[model samples]
Target: MTPPSAPPPPADGLLAAGRRNLRALAHAVSHPSHPPTPLFADAPKRWQRLLPYVVVVALVATFLPLTITVLTDYGMSGGLAGAIAAVQTVPLLMIAHRPLQAWWIILPADVVGGLFALGGPASQSSWPWTPSVIVAYLFLMLALALRETRQTLIGVWLVTGAAGAVLGRLFPGESDGTNVLLLVLSAVVLVIGGALRERGEAQRRLVEQETISEAERAHRTLLEERTRIARELHDVVAHHMSVITVQADSAPYRVGGLPPEAQAEFASIAASARESLTEMRRLLSVLRSEDATGERAPQPGLDRLQQLVEATVRAGVPAGLSLTAGLAEPGRLPQTIDLSAYRIVQEALANVVRHAPGADTRVSVSSDGTDLTVLVVNGPPAGPASPVEAGGAGGHGLVGMRERVRLTGGTLDTGPLPDGGFRVAARLPLGTKEPVSP
Candidate 1:
């Protein structure tokens, strides 16, 4: 057997960790941070439109004061003082878009500016960290805290403290306590900024989740309405199949002297029809559960429209009805078309009642011998909306209406009016063929 490999030295482990940290620091210093919100986004519209000019003027105003302070108080040369002030203030403009890069520039400039101030007159005592430099750096730190990760923020704070410590040890000036003060203030700023950023992110995520949930609910409601329509249409097709089966089975008995071949054909037709009915019954069972016994009532037709409008009037909406001559006669239209028309009108009125409450509404049915038109229009709400309306138009009223019109091979148009109201119009063909079973 080969000898076992010895364990690596502890220093080697330390060295590897050090290299990894160096790489992380390099990455953190290079990449841009999150975009910051505009400083005056919530200002009045006219002011917001001129924000670019306002921001530029504000930055120049800030630069002028800092440059004057460094030149007059510290007794530094005018060119050097202006250069240092430019480096400190110019990066403030970039901090919103590129916090890390701005921090990299401003930190070194601050250290160099402070070092240069050390050569000034013995009377000036703001050495290692001037008041102007401290204020500027704190602003940058707050911006970084809002955009950068916690680890990056810690690294920035530590590096700042380390630079201050190195400068203090090398120079040993009277203003040595300024370094400690800046660090403490920056720590507080970082904490507050981080909390604000986290709150904004949480609110954004909540709004997005609500939007997705609403869309999913609407889709689910559409699927459920389709299932219900299929069950009703299944009943219509099943009725016709049963009638065919009965007629075919009685053909030979009702006629006299029928041939053997003819009798056999009639018997085969009845058998096939009965088999189809059996399959449909099985499908109907699957469509609704065993507990759906209350749904077995006969489907409504256009003849019930008058009763529906009357009931709606009794419920407090001022509604009217119009029916074309002979249009409400029984058997005037195919069973599928008649039922779909009634359902569409019913759903439209329900939406009006739920959404527009006390609005003036009209229900009209007319025919020009080929196609039938059903219209329901409502004016603006005359009273405050109900609590249910305040929550949302959460029901599948429009979805069910569209699905009914589609199955009957008709056209529907629905939209809001210019006067804060709504309209629903459906045109169903009077000669529509009976719908085939799915």
Candidate 2:
């Protein structure tokens, strides 16, 4: 027969890849060399966005007067003036699309454009270009600050200074030396501002990363604690409940020869208490740990099917077992699979004793190469009344059985049989066993 199929891998791989790509893109855009914070943090919401646009507009506005003067005095037409102005406008507008890492492109483009404008028809007066160039330098500084790039900030300063020097030569201004000095000073301010912005961005990124790490650590700790609790409850409560059930079943038989009324009453009380304790323990164990203990011996497997049958017989429930095929051949099966199978049988028998007492029960366990199958069927209760005691309708037994089968990638079905009893059938993959610590 074919080996059992493994469970499908988790579906989050694609989602994880997508998140990684997005993070890389954001880092390239906002941090470049440094780590990045959230996008909204790097691209501040309010006046920060408008500040870049404002600087660009102010620089262009300052240049308009110089262009107008040169055109008027040199007989330069409006078309030529508009064309020069449009060149600067187009590149600044493009900044909205490209990431700040591409700011180097804008620096050279702005400087060259400014020098060309100064040496052309707009050369009558240098006053307008001075403020315009300085304003452009300031805007470049702001962009560099936001981008946290030291080299770009320095480049912006050098380009602005060079443009001012060329303009002084072309226009022969009265205060040429002073104008150059002011432009040099402006560059210094831009560099300092850019440095500060970079520091802030770095700190923001560090804080965000720490927060994320802490939250993840806490979540993992909580999960581990829950798993430990589940394992503890399973060992403590399940063990005691098993012992109590054994004791309760033997109570009436041991007290034989007593008055019928006293015997029946004592049996009823014992049964009632056993059922109550089972329900209480089941509820309490809900919070138990999930971790399997390695020190504890692994649970019994299919080999213990006979022992499970005997336990049911001692509990006053007649159970017959049959195996048509797929025995593990000694050590072929893993411990986890064995334990799960044993538990499935144990639970099925327990249900038969509690819900179908005195009913004839048949258990069939077989393997079909890759899969192990178990079928438990019971006849109707032998007495006139239902075997299910009052207030014993907590459905945790079936739920627990299903949980066991699910962990092994198995299937289970249980319902009332058409013949007036109940039947539970399970199919577990033999190969897709989970890890058992022991």
Candidate 3:
């Protein structure tokens, strides 16, 4: 068995805390290896570029007279007083580069300047803190507050107060509350500068987050559109495969074929078509989201265009539809082409209603035997755009339309009209296997 150790003394904890604080202060002030922090890094305008130089000029102008006054009042030689004034003022330029280092230089220069100015014939009210030194230190504190950590700033403030106290004790005279005044002014400047820097950082973070969110949303929308296109195309392809399977299975019996090899070949064709349909359905299941119940209704075709246009007209956008007489004949166009054409027109009209409320719109569909042309155009809005529209409600209008047309090897054209309206036109080849006319 080991002997138990005695409890540590209470002073041990206090000593540890003091050592920790001192270490923290040392770490806060000593590391000045970071790149320079520009005061106007993002200034884009001409006046903004010139503003920093203007501030330097103004500070120089103000410090000039104060330096002359300090020289006369302190009764120091010209070169000595001017050198001290230069130490106080010139380090301000370094604040943009190494603020903590600048503070280290300025604080000591301030102490020495105060020591010489004490009890001078010209020194009346102000004691250790001359008007010029107060102003210069305040500026330095403001820069430090913006760039440095709060611990560093607290260290700087504590050191400033300690310096003023030491100078007061060394030369006891009518100190005139200059020490308190300088500390209070520097504290206020530090607080305001810290607040402004925090606000700017928060704004930058917010903008960056918004940009990332926008990119993610666009990517999500693209994936959803592709899934929808695959689902619809699956349905179209499945229908054609089902027809091929039935025709191949029935050909031997219905056509009165005599050869056994021919019947076996027909059977093979039917089996292959059925297998393909089964795989497509499996692939479709993977494409569909879990929440989708699977639409069992027959997909709409070009025949539904009139009803779509009528619905849009009832919704407030005065609209008209035109369909060529031949398009009415059933089986005139394949199911894939028919579905693609209908979806393009449906999305286009929906966009008009949402984006250009109360605008005149026209939708026309015609087939020239080799190609099918669809056109939907809407005029400018008769009323002000709703907040939702102006803010871009994030509809997948153009994305869906372009995808549908592309599946059928079609061409799509969409843009804003010169009359402040919108146009969406698509030309689809009549036969998928045939080359499209230029």
Candidate 4:
């Protein structure tokens, strides 16, 4: 019986949501498309840091005038007014820290205070609302709307409705006070709060999408730049290569008394130059996740080692290949690694022809199941080491070979032999394919 497959990974929760929201906010704030007062506005560090303090001071000041007005209008006497001011101040302070809890405290206290104050001779003066009534309701409603989540705000709205019902019934007519006002204000708060919440959510999504679009744009720019560089390289490098091919192909007929072997060598040089040019074209046009328009040339691998060795021989380097014992199934190697191994051997041979002409060379590929090694050794040159190519170009052959080996998770070691010959050895590990970086 098949055991049920392990459950798919759980969706992210609150912590992930918080982090994503923070990232979106940061991106939005830094984006030029945003308004001046972005959710997490990017102001001067000092001002940005001080913004909370400024908000706190503003809230305090907003409520202070109302508190004084309440004491003046509702309190029976001077000492009583001061005491009333203290009572009102307490709730404002509490609301600053915990709006919901402050609402619970202030509602019953204000209702009871209003009922008891009715006994005083001056109680009838203020009529329905105390002088401070508008500010008190306004601050509390705004506080609830901003601080509470939408789900919790529903409960706040219900509670406000119930309070309104009770206060309207208890006070009645002229003593109805600000009960009707509170009810209307509660509805307004809910509408505004929900709208703002939805707006914020929309902004977060927009920010995330903008981030993705920006990344795609940057990637497209990179691909365009690569195409431009490839065009330039084709002009500078491929032109010289084409000239070499033409020169090598025509050299035998250009001069009289050339031996059969010398003519064959020219032919080999022409063929090798053409082959290099084909590979360069393949590499220049490669793009990540691209679909080829036609079937591409099969990449050269270890199986082509004999033909490569023969070509090098014809190019004046008597080259031999040593295939290791354990590499029983060459096809099992990763396509990229196989191609890389072949290129490393090919480049090493070409380097010998240019840098150490007429040198005897050996190419070896060995695999012990887990790792493959490709090593090339060429004997001391017949003449001085020519560091530059025949066309006066400082070739990047060694650097290119090292890069190919590295892409296959391999290491390359290359330097002059103790006796004056040059050696290029590459060690490639199996099982991993290195991704090409942009």
Candidate 5:
């Protein structure tokens, strides 16, 4: 059988340290090691809206070089003609960078540039700029579709198409059916891709939120279970120890006026019982949750066998406790070993108080390399007064101690001693121990 595992340390220190470090890192990141303010925060939306206008200006700029070439051939001064053409390209550059607000500036610039191209002394027709316009429009729409949702891309496409149709009507161009169909198909692809991206992002976020919620619920359930177990342990120890305390305190007074040696023995028993009560109280104090501010102390471990023996003594039982090795070096003993050892001793002493009052008891604890051994023996009840209430009442103390020992992969033997008393002995393996049956 496997030995019982050790209990976990209290969570307060580790959890607090983790939270402190996380908070510090969050504060440091928010402030940054070196801070810089970002620019153009509001520029993207404006740029999206002005994209079509920017495309129109770019198309106009593309036709300028050819127009200027013909104008110079017809006797226009080369330097003067080049200056006029250069002016038309300005709006295109500005609109490309600041699309939304560029319309107010570019619309007037477009009319002047258009007049110059159409009415110059060396003017020539370069009317159909459809291919350049279509390419620029497609590029802008593709960018918007990749960055935004379907609805926004659709709005942009509709606006650009309507404006383009109006310009085409005013300045007639040759267009084949296939070119128009390709343009429409490209626009449809942009809208579909944008819609899918938005849908996928939404679904991913929903799944993440659900996962977080489930984890939080599991954490709360674990906390509740821990609290419930703590409460049960507290209740069990308090009830049984309280009974032992009453019986121990009343024993000396009940058997009055005995021989000096007998009286001294009874007094020693009372003192031992008081000490046990004190240690039990100390153990209970440690078990109290940290939320309480009272001065209650922490519980005892296997290190306090003397105190246990003293308590047994106060209960009118003569207890001789011998320890070959103190708990100073638990070595590889698991937490279960420590807890079970403490509990087994506590239960054994309580049994002496209840079922073997005024009897001589011997408590011994020794470790042989890998196994811990505990033996508690008591001579029969001192008087005919039946030390225990009899029946099943005297059985449970031994059963409980055995069960605790077994959980640590130990063996327990409890039965009548040849000398007319009872003895309980347990051997708990330091490694790979299994639970003992009651």
Candidate 6:
């Protein structure tokens, strides 16, 4: 059997730990890329008037004992002693703006003090890996990690490691200062710093993405509302324009002979109105073509309710309409309310034609001064539904009715009735409006 291996050196544990940390850092960035000195991880807050000053005082305090030891034991001049103190504290002061660069400043300052300014490397860990320099680097790394990106963090870790490795070899200390173990410990700290930086970046990106998604969703909703308004405009305006064209064309015949110029002007108005109506219908078809059959038809309103009911009746459903609350009166309804009422009626009737075919359907409209109420009811179906039922709008008819009532600041109720029929009703509030003649 092979002889038992010698126990590993003490520094080997530090090396292993550092490598494990470096691996963890790599994994963190491979996937993606808090609080305080309470955690040894917070950057000083610059907004507080005394935070920077406090940091300077605290860093100076830490180095004070070391500074005196360097002065008395090394016999360094007073000016040189002050210079070493400055190297340790100034970087800590400047850490917020230029943390990585501050780290660079502290590292070489420690080297210079170790080699030339202070006494010989006689007492402890020599030149590069001295205690003072280690403290400076730790503080600086903690600050820099909060600000730097993953790539910059890797560069920082490498630079610090390489510098320590080279110096350790050149001026080896009593405690193996020039050894790879110093580089390992440095790697561990810097890797942890880099991991922290990446996490911060990832969280910032998540918040930004959420904000963008919210804005995009709002924009999309606005565009959809605009499109629906345009469709309603087409349906309502085209009907009025067609009526205007007919009235203009028939005015001379209905009233009496007119002057030649007046007749020509009326003809011009009729032609223009007909052209506009044609274009509106075309646009509506393009925007809302419901079937591949490609049938293009005029939009219907209350004026066309009789024709619509006749068609529904012919399609095997008996349908009728009742009107009250001055809604039955012609020519005084607000155009917006008229259009909404028509569309609501159309959608409810369509639902009946599809879902409850062969069922008797009744649509009733009643209004108090402030609100118009619409109700559509259908008897239970007599038999299996036709293909129209299978291919008809899925749940979208109710959705459209709800939106229409919502636009009017209204309430809608729809459900099965106790009598084995379905009921759809809406109470739409009418705001004050200047009435338009029919």
Q: Which residue pairs show collisions in model 1?
A: none
Over 1-438, each residue of candidate 6 has an lDDT whose tens digit, in order, gives 999999867898889998987786655433322212222233455346556557755876777667656544565767777777677666676665556556667767766665653334365434445556566566676666666565556656666676666665665543254435546665677678778767877887999999999789666655555457568777667768888999999999997869999999999999999889888878867766475343256444456666777888888888887877456456656666666777787778888777777888998888777877888899987767667567643434665676666666678899998777899988777776332321
Models 1 onward score TM values of 0.84, 0.38, 0.87, 0.43, 0.34, 0.56
Local error of candidate 6 at residue 370 (angstroms): 13
* Per-residue accuracy of model 1 over 1-438 as CA lDDT, tens digit each: 999999877998999999999778766656654555454344578777466446545764786577557655787877778888888778777665567777888899888888778767777777688887887788788878877877678788888998899898888854658899999999999989888878877987998999999899988898889879888988888878888999999999899799999999999999999999899878878877678863667778889999999988887788999988777788787788888888988898888888888899999998888887989999998887788786885578889988887776678899999999999999887674553332
Sort by TM-score, best first: what order? Answer: 3, 1, 6, 4, 2, 5
How many steric overlaps are in each model, in order? 0, 9, 0, 1, 22, 2
Off by over 4 Å in 3: 1-14, 32-34, 96-98, 173-175, 258-261, 367-371, 429-438
Shift in Å, residue 276, candidate 6: 0.8
Runs with alpha carbons beyond 4 Å of true place in candidate 5? 1-129, 172-186, 203-207, 214-218, 221-225, 235-337, 340-438
lDDT of 3 by residue, 140-229 (tens): 888788788778888888888988888778767647779999999989999998888778879989999999999999888878998997
**C-alpha displacement of 354 in model 1, angstroms?**
2.0
Go through the candidates in order and give each one's C-alpha lDDT.
0.81, 0.61, 0.83, 0.66, 0.58, 0.68
TM-score of 5: 0.34
* Runs in model 4 lying further than 4 Å from the true structure: 1-87, 90-122, 125-133, 143-152, 166-177, 189-219, 251-268, 284-438
Better-scoring candidate (TM-score), 4 or 5: 4
Candidate 5 yields a Cα-based lDDT of 0.58
TM-score, cand. 2 vs. native = 0.38
Best by TM-score: 3
Ten-residue stretch with the least lDDT total in model 2: 33-42
Q: Write model 2 residue lDDT over 35-71, tens digit each, in one string.
A: 3332233364767656555655665566556544443
Off by over 4 Å in 1: 1-30, 33-57, 289-291, 379-382, 417-421, 432-438
What is the per-residue lDDT of model 5 for residues 108-225, given as tens digits with 9 covering 90 to 100?
3433333344433423333222233334334444434444444444444454455445544665532223234434965776777567656766886998998998788656554544
